[model samples]
Target: MNESTRQSSEPETKRQGLSGNALGAIFMLLSGLGFTVYIVLSKTLTEDVHPVFLAFWRSFIACLISVPVIMRAGIGKLKTRHPGLLLLRSLFGTLGFTLAIVAISADFDLTFSQFNAISFSRSLFVTVLAAIVLRETVGIHRWGAVGVGFLGVLIMVVPGVFIFWAASGGDGFSLDLGTMTAIASAFFLAFAIVLVKSLSAELSAVALLTYANVLSSVLLLPFAIYYWSTPDLETWGWIIVMAGVGFVAQYCYISAVSVGDASFISPLDYLRLPMATVADLIIVGMLPGMNVWIGAAIIIVSAAYITFRDRNKKAQKVKVLTDR
Candidate 1:
């Protein structure tokens, strides 16, 4: 290729790259909106159906949706060298899904915004788990971010604990089941992520997703059957919509990451916090307390910093390898 032609092609390539990133940003925003809708629907339907049952249906629907993808990718692609780890990952993921639903349900006192805000702690958990489990070097910078993130979590939860204590005339301090479950869900989700990181070396993304959804459906089946209550037609309609929206959200997130750097798109996910807060006010007629706003801001900034730091580390590693 001639120099003038190469220069012209370089400009076109840059334009195409920018367009892809723009599209990725749009997809990330849509994914956030879709997940917010799914969460709001879950909160609404949990009034009439058990959370375990809802989780099973969601997983089963996702599995059904994966059938086409698996068929196209070839069933052999679903095979993995490490079945035990995959199963464990699915179990943690299912637990996370069920607990998250319970946390946001009417049975729990937590508002949608609080649930969303607390969920951001998953990144903090991931950093800690990566250091301990994966033995990845976590610098003091990330450790400090993790600390700040936990402080944010405490900021959000302690206010409610004190409120409960005051209501009890200072007899005791307690965290509500909803808050506890939300935090637990984040830990389990982060564990699942760590497991996925281990498994990704041997399994394709399609296989990983398929295994998780199919295994989650199987794992939750008995519990779902035990807790099942027949939903009215309207409730069933919403359930179906929720599953479809959740699947689309997952697709949008994958699409965003495929087209752009994950670190660039990840912070857009925090959009769900405000989206959920608005959704709660409009749908559930509730607003997040001031603590939620302040705490969520802190957690998001910390998590974003951690994400970028990880990205930079990976880039440096790649650069070093290329320079070699």
Candidate 2:
């Protein structure tokens, strides 16, 4: 508590914080890469299996994978007395995955620029939802960043509709409903993330994942039943790959945030944009041009700005309450 002791501890604390951040960043980076690969592989398999069916089965497999682990940890320990909130979180999580992956598989060949542009909208959605649903406050500065981000979206989108590809068709394959669904996936995922954060103080990350995946799989079963298609050997191979790798990526990501500050860790999620872009360029020969980067840059900047402001506001509130 003395000056000399506190001064000596400052450097040590800072170093440890930085080290933790670095480790968390590496896990996030790898998790992002795994998810990027999942998207690519999902695209590769869309020729055979519907994305809805694919998402459902993969989630089912993930549930199976996580069960033994959850049981080993003691399922009784995982169960919170609060069941309703857990159900809502799982429902949102399920909708997010089912809609997003299905949309991606259906429209993997859409303009990457527009695709990425729509992806950016999720940050804005999350910010707005945080205010409305979580009762979080937002000030003018963060709102300004949201506006600038949307302006960048217009820049990327306007040209695609009127440019070279316009001659091929109206909107040049822009305005696809699947693209919008993917964007909705981002919104739902963000909201689900916020819920997960709220629950983190009460539940272990593994427990939350176990509940979410299993419940989501159950919710999607009706859809899967309606669209049932027997998986051939080729389809089975991709589903297994998607299930295994996607589970790894998803678990790593959830664990990353569980062990670190969300404000510090969430920004690393943006790394997926570049990873997917590069993978598409290398594997599928889709070189996303300036528009993708420009729009994505704007979105990433805006999302980071929003998170930073929120964290500061939250810390200020804590300080105020503690002062009283």
Candidate 3:
């Protein structure tokens, strides 16, 4: 094998047994679980909590918790110090989060699996957005992969409505404002994630996180007031859990992204379904039938292909820059 072949083969070889890999995997899985629980909890309220209120409170908690850590790191280390970009990130990320909550409130609402599918679409969006924003070349094979991913979304959604209609016997297609909002949330979030990832290169993860939360909390204070409802003790408890878990999940998730090649990691991203499917079955007594399973399979496969292509493209670009 050539040097490049040998280099690629070695990472595969090192994973032959359990090393420290278990710890990272465990943390990642925990992170996933935490985020999933947050989604499930959010969906439990009967509009008892407004979307804006959820955003403000959750972000407020995150910012409050993050402040001490940021201080300990000193003012300079809090972030990369790009004010313009940080400002923009905060604005866009807040908008994304706000819109996402609105969408969730409007749609099928959240389950563990559904949250994963929607949040993970961010990765897919990054690929397509990068092509446009950066003017990067997109190969046909890459476009084909994007098409396949969308096909999977269609599969999951179309039959979903039909299944609802059938379940009702003579009702109608389950097209509602909430469902459409959920779909739109998925689309916009994908774009938001791409923007965040781009800015990530120039910012500290904590900084990126802190600004988004703090600024969002500040910006949302006025709007969140109108929708504020008296959350019961149970609701408050869930909010606390959601805030804490969300912080931990993002922290560890960023760590995972740092250590592993997204190409390799992205494929394992498919494992979200199995994890969430199991969670949903246990928590909500809902197991996906054959249709959801098939659709998920297509999405997983396409996502893997897209990640592989993106990594290869990125590597080539880095190589050219280094050679220059």
Candidate 4:
């Protein structure tokens, strides 16, 4: 190819890449908003329905939502050589999703924003888990970021502990089950992320999701059935809405990652924090406490730093390799 031709083509290629990234950012934003609704709807429903039953419906509805995708991909696409790891992923993913519902079911007196803030702790957990479980070499910057992130978590959590104590007239400091379950949700989610990193090479994303929904539905079925109460049509509508939004959010997230670099798309997920706060104010008439704002800022900054730094490092490595 002539030099002038190649130079002209480069700009076009760059424009296409930029356009793709923009599309991805939009998808990720919609995903964040969808997830925000999912949280609010789930919280609203906790009044009459058991979380276990809610989780079961979530899985079942998600599976129903996936039917078209699964059919389009065909049965062959669902086959995976890594069944054990997929099972492990299903186990942790199920725990993470169900525990999140369980956490919200508890009367923590927290707004949806405050409750959802704990979910961001998953990134910190993923960093540590990558080092321990995957034996991935994490640099000093990442480690430092993880430390600061945990400090932010403490900032959010310790204040709540104090508030609870004062409210209970000095009933000695103890973290409530709701809070612990939220943290556990983050932990399980992190583990599932690590497992995904391992299994991504051997399995298609569709296959992984297909198994996750199907297996979680089966796992939660007994508990869901035991606690089942027939929801009125209105409540059923809300449940379907919750599950539909969640499915859309999941689809958008996957589409975003497929189109753009994960690092580039990840910062968009933080939009859920503010979205949740807005949903809280509008739906529940609640404002987040100062601790949530302060700690969430710290966590978001630390996570963004980690993502950007890692992206730069990867870019430099690619450049060096290309030059050679």
Q: Which prediction has the highest lDDT against the true structure? A: 1
lDDT per residue for candidate 4 within 114-143, as digits (tens), equals 667889989889989999999989999899
- Model 3: lDDT equals 0.67
Q: How many angstroms is residue 72 displaced in model 3 relative to the true structure, after the best TM-score fit?
A: 1.4
Candidate 1 structure quality by residue, lDDT tens digits, 2-68: 9999999998988775676788899999999998988888888998899889999988998899878
Each prediction's TM-score versus the true structure: 0.91, 0.85, 0.81, 0.90
RMSD of 3: 5.2
lDDT of 3 by residue, 180-282 (tens): 5555665665665666766777666776777777787888898888777798898888788777877787777766666655665556546667787887898
Candidate 1 residue 164 Cα shift, in angstroms, is: 16
Q: Of the pair 3 and 4, which is ahead by TM-score?
A: 4
Winner of 1 and 2 under lDDT: 1
Candidate 3: stretches off by over 4 Å = 1-24, 78-82, 105-112, 159-175, 316-324
Q: Which ten-residue region of model 4 has the weakest summed lDDT?
A: 165-174
RMSD to true structure for each model, in Å: 3.1, 3.7, 5.2, 3.3
Candidates' lDDT values, in order? 0.87, 0.76, 0.67, 0.84
